[model samples]
Target chain A: MKAVEFQGLEVQYGDMPALRDASGSFETAAMTAIVGPNGAGKSTLLKAALGLIPSTGRVAFFGKPLAEMRARVAYVPQRASVDWDFPVRVIDVVVQGLYRELGLLGRLRLSHRRRALDCLERVGMADYASRQIGALSGGQQQRVFLARALAQNADLYLLDEPFAGVDAATESAIIAVLKSLRDQGRSVVAVHHDLATVPAYFDRVLLLNRHVQAEGPVAETFTPEALARLYGGLLPQLS
Target chain B: MSALDFLAFSAPPMLIALLAALACALPGNFLLLRRQALLGDAISHVVLPGIVLGFLLTGGASTPAMMAGAALAALAAAALIELLQRSARLDPGVAMGATFTAMFALGVLALELSGAGAVHLDVEHALYGNLESLIWFDATDWSALITPATLATLPPELFRMAATLALLAALCWLFWRPLVILTFDEGFARSLGLPVRLLSAGIVAAATLAAVAAFAAVGSILTIAMLICPPAAARLCTHRLGPQVALSLVFAAASALIGYVLGGYGPLWLGLPASVSAAGMIATTSGLILATAALWHKR
Candidate 1:
């Protein structure tokens, strides 16, 4: 069974095609890593699939439309996508994840606060809940974002570059969390940048370069030749 | 500065400025945080054309007509900015700058082309406004605070400003959560099924409402000043969004009070014969406060 699937998806930015007829699917209850070269429309693919940006074609989750499953899906965008300098506390951001349950004007209660703290605790960031988001290091900020995604209590998680610029400890902690979520039968999809860690961290791999080059189990698909073809031989390590 | 004299000659304009400053400052928090602070300046500028056009069409500056016109023009300017940013691939600041300058020039041209310039629609009025003349003659003393007839004689602007402030505050409180989330991370907000586009448009709409209403009570100068200055300064004073917003309002009220008093009576205290433009003074005071915040943040 597929967790999420897209067919013939296309995105154009001012006459330039960022994504071109991309068709792919990730299996249910598994971890998939979307690996691509720079400007390969990796982030654009996630944005388009989630309806965060304008794109042609449709995406479905669990054989149902996104609207029907929105409550069950959580997304953690790239940490650099937002202005970290924004005056928001770590707890406030985590609390935002509960906005759907909180309703439009629902006040945060003690229970809500406890739940948010629990999410922070899972990320090992409970102590920094009151600290400003901007003051945290890159890895810590990324973990805080993951905590926010966790607070949603969703069945599927979409993460964009979750490990980029993070420290080794943070990277291991994040992978452990993702693996735990997968072990619990939830699906995890991340736009991963590190070529060396693909097989070690992800069970499935999708090599995308404006379109899907190859996609299947990481053992069968994430190879030097596949990456060489996807990156047009630009990646020195692949050589 | 007798009680009666102050009530009759000064209270209305001062109160109007305060209310207008507060209203504009509230939305300014979101704008500054989202790096769209100049949108306030743009909306304030575009409202001039709307006001002039409304007056030209209606033959008088009716409050409803002026507000509606300003709102329409602000929406148009915002649309143009978005179009330029999306289609033309322009930076947000550059798009806002281009759109607002053209709209403001259109307003000036409309004022000149029409015979409205001879009336109250002059550029000077658009900038400095008739704040000094918004006095309450019937409110001669403290009794005027409660007397129905005396209160009825208060400047219409005072009521308009108060109503505008209340409406903006209520709307902010109602949509406070979505507003903060969207301002912080638009993509995450979208993933949450938060109607990201509508919330974004709502923010611009609220800003237009605040800018147009404030533009009516004070001039565009004070409207822009209070919108960006207070929020920008408040951002430096606090790292928390709620506290920053509260501090922005405090800065706004302080600027209004200090600037109004200094503009109105500082000349008298200095033994000068006349006073300065309250709108300009208010803008200056806001800038000073922003500078102070920057320095304090440095510490």
Candidate 2:
């Protein structure tokens, strides 16, 4: 079954069209990479799908509207999208993920802290739980974000440039977590920045510019010609 | 001044200033985090025209009318700023700068041309408030404080401020999670099925209410100062949201108490007969706190 499907999703920013009728789907239990060149509206597609921006589209998850499935989906925005200097502890962020269970006005109790701590441990961020979020490195902060997403206990994870600005170790750690999530029958979709890792990291690839150029199993769809077409012929050497 | 003297002359305005400061500081935390500190400043500025308009419409300077005017003005300013940022594609800072200055100028012009300037509302009152005038004439001694008749005679702004602060605190509790998430990250809050737009509007609403409630009694100087400085100082003191909020209350209260005393008596003790502007003193004290925190605060 498809985890998420979008048809003819259109987004216009000011005068420029960011996403023009981009349509694609992330199959359940698979790892998909949304790869594109600069200004390709890669993030726009996710924002539109999440209803964060106004868009005209038929988007569905598990054959239901996104509003119905919000609790089941976890979204990890680009790290740069948030202010690092915000005064919140590492653990406080992870607890933000438990909002579904905590509900509005639910006092944060020990059980919530324990569960949040567990999610942080899963991302190797438990030790930094009490530290201020800004004190951590970019990778560490990214891990905290991932920990928060994990704490959501979501079945579908949508990440934007998860590996950007992170260390090699963080990259591997993130991939390992995503792979483990896929192994456990969950779906993972990310807006990937690094072209070189498409084949190795993602089982499926969606080549996007203003629209989806191609999308399918990475072996066939992630071909050099498709990469050239997606990046407008300035394709990086795909060894 | 003696304790009795403080109770009689200084208590009412000081308490009012403290309540207003706390109220403004509460939302200041969220606004500062959202980088909308100038929104508070903008809302406070437009209150002049809001009250003036209220007076014009009502043909009198009734408290409710002026308050309604301030609230409407604050909402209009917020909408205008949003429009400038969205439709006009101006930067948020530029939008706020353009909207507030124009509204404030219009307010001053209205006051000059209109008869609203004849009453308690004026340029000076709008800037520094009638804080010194909000004295406790009924409280001649300590026993007067407990007497029901004397308590009933207390300035209406004191009750208004207290009620405003209590309402703000209640709203904060009810909307805590959404407010926190919305301030930290709007997109993620929307993704969480939290009403991001409503919360965004709510922040402005809270700020507007604060500016209106405080502006009449303490003026724009203290309102704007409480809306930025205390929370900013709290931000430097701690990176935890709860601690930061609590610390802001401390800073706000200290600023109000110390500033009111200094403004009321500092000149008297310095061989001068006149007191300074309490609103100015309060705002200045908050600034010093922020600067000192910036220079010396650890952790």
Candidate 3:
């Protein structure tokens, strides 16, 4: 099933076009990596997909509009974009993921707290639940964000640059978690920067540079020619 | 002085000041968390012109009339700042500085042109306030306190501060979760389908109300001080939002009490003849508390 579909999407910052006439679809139970050079609108495409930015487009989830199915979607923005020095505990951030279910005045039940702790355990951050978020390292912060997304229990997860500055062990752990989500028949779309790990980590790749350059299974679409076209000829040899 | 005389003379002003401090501190935490402390400063400045306009139109400094004018002026100032930032693409600080200074200057000019100098509508009163003057002098006897006439004789500023505090407390209680979520992570809050726009606007309005309500007693400078300092001090004390808010309220109340006592009596203790400006003293106390908290945290 098509978990998310974008048609004729366009986003502009001032006079410059960030994503122009972009269109694509992601199926359920697949790990899709959006790969591109810097300024390639990879983040912009994800934001526009969720209508976080002003964009002219039609975004549907499972044949329904995004607004109607917003509760079923989880988004983890780039760690670099947030203020790490903010005064909040690790558990506080994880609880924010349940805000939708908690609503404005809903109390946090013991069951909800247990679920959040379980999500933290899944991301290996249970020990740091009481620590301030700013005290964590780069990789630990990324894992905390993943724990937040995990607590949402959404059917579709959209992550932006989750592996931008993590250690090798943390990277593999994150990949393992994503693969588990895929195995559970959930869609996981990530804005990925490391090209070397594309085929190894992702089942599908969407090459982007202000638009969808090439998109399909890793073996078919992530070709040297397509990557060269997307990266403006600064292509690396890939297996 | 006897205990009754002390209660009659000092307690009213102290309570009023404490309530005013709390009113500003509650919403101040969210403003500080959102990194919009300057917005609170801007609202305080812009509301001056509204107060002057309200005085001119009504020929009396009624709370409702002044509050209405101040609310309108605050909204305009906020809108102007936003417009300047978006349309002219100016920096937020520059936009806020421009709009607030112009409005404050207009307020000063209006005070001058309207011949309100003979009244209590001067720049000194607008900025420094007259906290010392809000005395409950109508209670001639201790029995009058329990009588219905005591209600009629209570200082109007006291009622205004109490009402404002109550409203602010209710708002904070009702919207605590959404406000905390939005302040911590706005993008996640938006993705959760929360009414981000409405929540932002509500916070802005609440801040404006606080500034205006505290204007008559604490003035704009003290309002800004109370709004930013206590929260900052609280931030230094705790890493959690709930604890931070509770600590801020405690800090605010402490500032108000200490400031009032020091301003009213510390000069006599120092062998001086006169008291000091209670509002100014309160602002200074809040700043001192914040500095102490920072130092203590570093230790």
Candidate 4:
């Protein structure tokens, strides 16, 4: 079954079209990478699929509507977006993942708290679970956020630029976690920037600008023509 | 100050400080996380016009009118800032600076123009509350409707403070997930089917209420100390929102006590009246908290 499907998706921020007429289906248990240059709508596409941004299109998870499938999806945003100095411990940040399943006003019961710690252990961050998030290295912080996603135990995970600023070991660890998730029948879509790691990491690629240039198996679809089209220089302005 | 005397002066301030801290810290968390620290300064300054207008229309310092006016005015200031930023495409600081300064200036102008009965708010009074005055303000008149079998009873000021704190606590708890998600990642929060706009507006409104209520006890200027300092200090000390908020509360309560002691005792030694100096004490104490936390963290 399709894990995520977007049909005729269109997004705009005011008059600027971030995504236009994008359509695709992503299989569950497959690793998909969205690649593009700055302002290329890669993040916008992921956000739109997650219902994070306003869009005119249809997105579904496992044939169910996006709204109904929220609890099944976990999101890891770009590291730059979060306040690194926020006064929260690693365990505290991880526990935020279980918030959707537990009613917001509900207490963080012992079981849920234990599960949060377990997720941290899965990411090799159990020792840092009580440390303030601000004190962790970039990769360690990313692992804590990953632990948050793991705590959710969601079927679909959407990660935005998790590799940025992360160390090599952390990157490898993240890849291993993603691979494990795929092996366990979960869908993972990440917006990636490193062209070199594409072949080694992702099974599928979606090249985009304001619209999808190409998509499919990594080798079969990531063509030179598509790269040129997606990253072409902007037209010169007339004086 | 003796423990009894400290209790007399410190209790009300502590209660007010606790509510004030939450009001500021709750939204301050987002403001800090969102990198909108100046917004607190903006609201506090801009609300002056609201207070002036409220006084003008209601014709006095009655609690309801002053608070309503301040809330409306502060909200208007927030809306105005948003409009300028979105429609005008100006930087956030530019938008906030223009709107808040203008509103604040207008407030000063209105106060000067009115030439009516001398309103209780002057420059120093605007900066801090008269804690000695508060002690004589007779906060005991309001009655509580308690169940006979119930094991809980509280004084009038305590009841009001508790009720106000409860309202904010409820919102924070109920929206904890979305608020956390939004604070950490607005884009992700929105994607997860959360109503980001509505949630933000609700938070802003709560912040406004917290600001207005806080201003009544500590005055406008000192209210900001409670809002900005605790959360910031907590940020230096912790990373989780729960502990951060708890730590901020602890710091705020301690500051209240310190302020009361300094205010009550320093007059005899330093030749400054306690009532006139309370706000300074609180602000200095809070600032010290932030500085000390920062220094300790660095080491």
Candidate 5:
């Protein structure tokens, strides 16, 4: 089943067009890496898909439009976007994942809260449950955020630069989690920063620079020629 | 005072004080978290016009008039700040400063023009409450008794209503973890499929309501101090929201009581005016707590 499909997707900020008419389909149970340089609309494309930004185009998840498919999707934004000094416990942050499944103003059942704690344990953070989130290290905080997504229990996961600043161990752990999700028939679209890991990490790759440069399995589409065009050739000319 | 007096006397005041503390502190947590700490400062200052408008419209300091006026004007100020931030590309600080100063100025001018100049407010009394003055005022005394207790004694200052409202508001917040997440981390909160905008609007409304209710009894200018100083002090002592909230309430109650007593009696023994002297004492105490916390945090 197609997990995500973007048709004539375009995104803009004020006046700048971040992503132009990009179209593609990502299959279920596959790790798809969205890669591009700064301003390549890598973040914009994921945000647009998650309905976080206004874009003129059709984006669907599981054959349903984004608006309708919101409940089935979970997102983990870039770590830098949040304030570390926020006064909340690690569990308080994770419990937020149950918000969608619970009604707009509905209260969480005790059983649902237990599920949240269970997800925290899955992320190896059961001990950090009561600790203030601000006290956590970068990777630990990322794992807490990952736990929040896990609590969402969504069919699809959209992560934006989850490994921007992290230790290698944490990186591998995150990759393992994504791999585990894929094994469970869940889909994940990660906006990856490290170019070297593209072939090893993701099953398929969608090269973006304001448009769909290419889309196919990483083994075939990640050719040296495609890499040059996305990074070397287009970057200097645009700037 | 007798032991019975201690038990009976403090209960009512403590209850009111606790409620007021929570009302100011809970939303204060959000404003502080948002780094819009000064937003309280701006709203409290500008709410003068709203209060005056309310008094003028109703021909008195009635509850509906006062709260409605404050809310409308405060909301207007917030909207204006948003507009300035969006259109002029002004930083939030600059926008808030501009919006508040203008609203406050308008409020002062309106009060003077309405022949209430003699009663026109100064900022010091507006931000902080004269808790001593509230000692004599009781809500139960004024109306037909709702309960048997009311038949025997006068109700305390209507401020109890504000406290009760604060408790109700805080209870709402306890269930609204999703709302707090959105405020502190909008991106991730949205990713979880939370209704980020709706939750935010609800919080803003709650914060506004709390501030306005507290403004009626505590006064406007001091409302910011009460709202901000306690949370500021609490942040030094705790890292989690629940504890921070608890600490803030304690600080708020202590400030009000100590500030009230010192202002009332401190100047009688010394050679100072009670009102000014009391405000100075509360302000100094709150300032000291905040500074000490800051220094401790640095250490």
Candidate 6:
């Protein structure tokens, strides 16, 4: 089943087109890496799919509109977009994932706290649950965010630049977590920048350069020719 | 006068000031967290014209009329800031400063034109309120406190402030989760179908209402101070939102009581002839508290 499908997705920032008529589909039970050069609208595509920004396009999840299935989707924005000095504990950030099901006035019961801690544990951040979010390291902060997403228990996860500025251990840990999600038949789509790890980390790859250059299984679509076209032949090593 | 007389004269205004401070401080934390601290200043200034307009239209500065005017004025100020920010591409600070100054000037001009300068809605009272004038004179004796006539004698501003506090408290209690989530992460809150716009509008309305209710006793400047300083001081002491809010309330109450005492009686001990402005003293006290907290936190 298709986890997310975008048809004629167009985004403009004041007159410049950020993403021009991009169309693609992400299949379920697999991990997809949205790879592209700088200013390639990789983040814009995820934001558009989640309806976080205004774009002229049609997006669907499980053959239905995103609005109807919003609750089943979890999103992790770029870490740099958040204020590190925000006064919240690591556990509080994770508990926010349960905010939807808990409703406005719903109290966090012991069961909910346990589930949040469990998610934190999944990301190897259980020991830092009581620490303020601002006190964590860069990779630890990213893991806390991933823990928050895990607490949501959404079937489809959209992450932006989760692997950026992380140590090798964290990079492998995140990939392992994404693989675990894919093993459970959940869909994971991430905006990835590194080209060397594309084939090894992701099952499906969508190469974008203001539009979809190619999208398919990594072996078939993520070819040296596609890299050359997307990168304007600048990536001689890949080519 | 006896101690009872002192208590009777001072308790009502002090309570009113405390309630007003609490009302403002509750939402102040959210404003500080959202980095919209100047919005409080803007709302307070713009609501002056609304109060004046309400007084002009009603022929009396009644509570309902003043509240409606203040709410409308605050909403207009907020809208104008947004308009100027978007259309003129002005910085948010510039837009707020421009919009509020213009509204406040219009309010002052309206007061001058309407010939309502002699009333309590004058410019002096709007900027620095006469808290000492809110004295309860109905009780001939302390026994009158139990009588129904005590209600008639009680300052109406006190009840208005108390009611506003209740409403603000209820709103904070009811929408605590969404407000925190939205302030921290707007995109995530929206993706969760949390009605981010409506929640923001509701918070703005509550802040306006609190500012309006506090206007008669504390004035706009003091209201802005109360809305910002206590929460800011509390934030320096705590990292969690819940603790920050609680500590802010405590700080607000302390500032009100201590400032009221210092403004009203401290001058007497120093051989002064009259008390200082209680609202000014409260604002100053909050500033001092914030400064102290900042120094301590830095240390």
Best by DockQ: 1
DockQ of 1: 0.88
Model 4: CA > 4 A from native: A13-15, A228-239, B1-30, B82-92, B113-124, B137-162, B173-178, B271-275
- Give model 3's TM-score versus the native structure: 0.96
What is the alpha-carbon lDDT of model 6 when measured against the actual structure?
A: 0.88
Off by over 4 Å in 5: A101-127, A232-239, B1-19, B55-63, B83-90, B109-160, B163-171, B268-280, B295-299
> How many residue pairs of model 2 clash at the backbone?
0
Among incorrect, acceptable, medium and high, the docking class of model 2 is high
lDDT of 1 by residue, B210-266 (tens): 888888778889998999999999989988888988999999999999999999878
Measured over the true interface residues after superposition, the C-alpha RMSD of each candidate is 0.7, 0.8, 1.2, 2.3, 2.5, 1.1
- Alpha carbon deviation, residue B131, candidate 1 (Å): 1.5
Lowest lDDT block of 10, candidate 5 chain B: B136-145
Of the true interface contacts, each candidate retains a share of 0.91, 0.87, 0.73, 0.84, 0.58, 0.71
Model 4 chain A scores worst on lDDT over the 10 consecutive residues at A230-239
When summed lDDT is taken over every stretch of 10 residues in candidate 1 chain A, the lowest stretch is: A230-239
Deviating ranges (above 4 Å) for candidate 1: A233-239, B61-63, B141-143
Per-residue alpha-carbon lDDT of model 4 for B65-125, expressed as tens digits? 7777888999998888777876778898899899889999988898899953276757666
Question: Which of the predicted structures, 1 or 4, would earn the higher TM-score when compared with the native?
Answer: 1
DockQ of each: 0.88, 0.85, 0.75, 0.53, 0.50, 0.75
lDDT of 3 by residue, B1-299 (tens): 77677656787888889999999999999888877788889998888788778878899867677778888999999878867876678887898899999998997788789886677666777777777777778766687678887756778889889999999999999999889878877777778878877898788788888888888777877899999999999999988889999999999999999999999888999999999889888999999999999999999
List the global CA lDDT of all models. 0.89, 0.90, 0.88, 0.77, 0.76, 0.88
Model 4: residue B23 alpha-carbon error in angstroms: 5.5
Candidate 4, residues A1-239, lDDT tens digits: the string is 89898899999887888888998878788999998888889888888888765689988898999778888988898888777776667887888787777756677789998999999888889988789787999999999989989988999998989899999999999999999999999999999988778888999988888778787988887666667677785322212
lDDT over C-alpha atoms for residue B184 of model 5: 74
TM-score for each of the candidates? 0.96, 0.97, 0.96, 0.84, 0.85, 0.95
User: Residue B38 CA error for candidate 5 (Å)?
Assistant: 1.1
